[model samples]
Target: MARIGITGHSNLTAASAPLVREALVTQLSLHHDRLIGVTCLARGADQIFARAVLDVGGSFEVVLPAADYRDRKVKPDNAAAFDELIGKASQVRTMPFEESNRDAYMAASEHVLSSVDAMLAVWDGRPSGGRGGTGDVVQAARERGIPVTVVWPEGAERE
Candidate 1:
């Protein structure tokens, strides 16, 4: 079984979503029935990855950045998708923080990294805009000797 974690841009361009989703599906298919996706369930890339996992008949786990992540971090426009994915997760883990700050996000990413075999990053090779962004997660995974696959499709772009 392969337990793969995900980190990516949350503001992907409209056209990039399908491209990223296709790439995720292709990658996840390699593991087939044994795939287990781990994600923070953020909008854009995280949600796309979760859907791809399910489409590939793979189960997934979620790592919430904080207790209030759903209420505080998820925007109204994305709440439905966030809740749906949460309900479908095989397991859900929440960080110890009450607020969804940068520290909490980083801690949650670290938690995901600790349990996964590899990391799938949907980054465009740019440095992270914040402390717990895709780049940071990818770097952390590499530092821990976990293999990381960058999955920015040819036409993928950030908003």
Candidate 2:
């Protein structure tokens, strides 16, 4: 079993989000019952990934950049979902932070990436907002010799 890391746009849904989620879950399920840890922050891809981890009967973990549950005040929906995931997770780690400095981002990423045997990155073809370049995180995992899987949605042709 491999521990997979998940990430994607926090606001995407329907056409985009579900497709990416499908691709990720498909690949992760291949790990069979050995699938152990699934790590995620708290946001769009994070929420979707959490649900998928539960559906697959795999272990899930959340590593937050905030101190504790207090960050909820800034993200009611995300906070609620994060809390819900916490209940479902086999393990949860909180690294007090505000998502403002590089230190926090690195710490959060470190926990999420290090916990698992591999990383699953959901890509929508662009840089994410304030969460640092997810591409960088994926690459970092590679540098650590962790396997990385990607879920990319086929964008509709432009008019």
Candidate 3:
């Protein structure tokens, strides 16, 4: 079994979703079976990764930044997907925070990086949005000597 973690853009546009999904699924296919995908279940990349994991007969382990992260951060349009993915997670780990914040997000990112064998980042090869963003997580994973694969197919655009 291979344990893979994901971090990526949260503002991916509708038109770019399929390209990201296809690229992600193709990369994950190399692992064959018994895949364990660890993610924060955020919108965009996280949700897409979770779906790919399920489609490939893999399990999901969700690491939430806060207890009420979904309600506080997830938009109404994406709430259903976030909720459904979280509900289907094989394991749910919430950081020790009541609300979503920078510290909580960092802690969750640390947990994902530390627990996974490798990380799949659906990044745009740009700087992070802020602390605990895709760039930060990828850097931390690299520092920890974990393999970090960047997945950004051409023509992928963010909203």
| Native-to-model Cα distance after best TM-score fit, residue 159 in candidate 3, in Å | 1.7
Model 2 scores worst on lDDT over the 10 consecutive residues at 150-159
Q: Which is better, 2 or 3, measured by lDDT? A: 3
Model 1 C-alpha RMSD to native: 0.8
Off by over 4 Å in 3: none
Q: Estimate each model's TM-score.
A: 0.97, 0.80, 0.97
Clashing pairs in 2: 1-34, 1-35, 10-44, 66-96, 67-96
lDDT for each residue of candidate 2 in 5-100, tens digit (9 for 90 to 100): 875555665566676667667776787765665554556677777777766777777776666434543386466666677788777777777553
Write the residue-wise lDDT of candidate 1 on 1-159 in tens digits: 999999999999999999999999999988854899999999999999999999999999999999999998899999998999999999998989999999998999999999999889999999988899889999999999999999999989887
Error of 1 at 118 (Å): 0.7
Worst 10 residues of 3 by lDDT: 77-86
| Tens-digit per-residue lDDT, 1-159, candidate 3 | 999999999899899999999999999999976999999999999999999998888999999999889789999988888878888999998898999988899899999988999999999989887898888898999999999999999999988
Misplaced by over 4 Å in model 1 are none
